[model samples]
Target: MTRKLEGQITIITGGARGIGRGIAKRLAADGAQVIIWDIRPEYFDSVAAGFEPIDTMAVDVADPESVATAAQTVLTTYGAPSIVVNNAGINGPVVPVTDYDFETWRRVIQVNLDSVFLVSRAFVPAMVEKSYGRIVTVASIAGKEGVPGIAAYASAKAGAIGFTKSLAKELVTSGVTVNAVAPVMVETELLEQMTAEHIAASKAKIPMQRLLGIEELAAVVAFAASPECSCTTGFVFDASGGRATY
Candidate 1:
């Protein structure tokens, strides 16, 4: 089979587990040299070992110094990335806005929104110089329709969608494609952070009557990260089963 990403250098953040890991596996299988960036170094060896030729780096995507240093290290070793997946995120604990923890809200925004800006800031210059790149950001359906309890998470994801659109436009003439995949409640460890009531409430909203599968969402990520996605940018691909009526 001819690989769409043959010899492509790909970077997947939070690739040690969950939806990020699914994206990493699919990208690596498609012949990209996948480099994973995750905060947990302990999971690196095992998670990377599952995919052929995939390497992992300990990176706190939200931290500017960590992102800059990690980007430098990755460039030195793997050259510039042709494909970038901004998948590192957290679904902050579910709580009503009145009772929400301020620090947790900040942390959620840091990981889910600020990291997108920081990662693009760190690596996109190289991509622009090369005049070629694919950027895929992981968003959420909650961003489209705000959920009641997870205000911080919903806000950050909405920001991610906006950021993807703005960046895509900026890179439209630069040979770089930026798009976002917004998935309805995918089955992942992040879901564990929510209360049972919250999880059930979210599922009830999905027209599919079920949570998305990780690989199912990864399929969209793979497409968005391929050179074949040439003409589309600033677009949000909804993988929310039948719930996305708009």
Candidate 2:
């Protein structure tokens, strides 16, 4: 590896497993010091053993207080992070809007959408002070093209994309770049939350007729978080396997 991100400090929310784990490992390998913030830290030891050592903190990203506390810890322990990946999210029940539970819809939006706002608000000022940062949100293709049976998840992701655009513009002249990565179905434990039919339908929408690879998504995110990605901000990088156009 070229170590393009050498000495950079990075934070990845929901990095205990799945897509978040993949991105964390990739960033660490590229020489960034990675810290994981997940609601569950019991699995951190096992996951960290498989790759380079990564610091872990138990955090409920959806909680404003929790994000604030964790952000302070990161700032004190690792100094200001040059990279922040807002990847914590959930797939709400596979039910139609008419059948979806109102509370569950709210929960999904809080976790997937509000967490982004809270976490970014907590750390962005430090980045602005230093005049350098990379903020990447893991959105979904469903956000761009709504999918049936996952209204809550899709709506939250759409909010994420919108947030990315808005923040990018706000920091356009501050040496901080904000962007998003929209991927189609990926082979992650989150898939277990969806029905088999839903999974199949998502994969079929991709021209590749396959789910995305964890490392593949990590590679794209690594680029977006790197110093080389200087000219693009507020852009949604696609990892949809040809499923997204426009």
Candidate 3:
């Protein structure tokens, strides 16, 4: 690693486990002072054991108040983060749209989509003032090509992608880049939220006939979060293993 993010402050939401955890480690390794905003900060110690210490704050990214408070604390303590990864999300129940519980649908949207808006809004001002920033959202292949059983999850992710593009354009001249990474199914604890049948179906869509690796996804996110990715904003980097046509 070239320490491309040296002297930068980075934040990763949902950094306690799964894809978020992997990204957190990668950013830390890349020489950013990494801070994790997760609902389960208890898992932070375990994730930080062999690496440089990472700051952790218990945060419910979906709640406006929680995000506001956390954002205040970070700005007060560490100044504005130069890198923000909107990786917190939930895989809503695996059910058809007609059978989906209404409350669950709202909850999914809140966590996966609404949080992106709140978190970005909170930190972007400081980033604009500083004249440098990177925002990366962890989206999914389901966002681009819908999945049958997870309508809520898919819809929220699609919204995230759109939000990234729109925000990127809004900040284009401000030196703040907004982008997203859309990966195919990865073998993470999130898989526990899906049905065995759903898992099989998802894997079958990939020409590679395999699940994406956490490290692979992390690598893509690292680049998007780095200064080297200077020319691209409002772009969705694909990690679909030949599954994506566009």
Best by lDDT: 3
Please list the C-alpha lDDT of all candidates, in the order they appear.
Answer: 0.90, 0.91, 0.92
Deviating ranges (above 4 Å) for candidate 3: 47-49
* Model 3 lDDT on a 0 to 1 scale: 0.92
lDDT of 3 by residue, 214-246 (tens): 999999999999999998999999999999998
| Order by lDDT, highest first | 3, 2, 1
- Native RMSD of candidate 2 (Å): 1.2
TM-score of each: 0.96, 0.97, 0.97
Better of 1 and 2 by TM-score: 2
Clash count per candidate = 0, 0, 0
RMSD of 1: 1.4
Q: Clash pairs of candidate 1?
A: none
**Distance from true location, Cα of 47 in model 1, Å:** 6.8
User: If the candidates were sorted by their TM-score against the true structure, best first, what order would they fall in?
Assistant: 3, 2, 1
Give one digit per residue, the lDDT tens place, for model 2 in 1-246: 489999898999998888898898888889988888999966665545366545889999999999999999899987889999999999989998999999999999999999999999898999999989999999999899999999999999999999999999999999999999999989987888989998888877899988999999999999999999998999999998887886
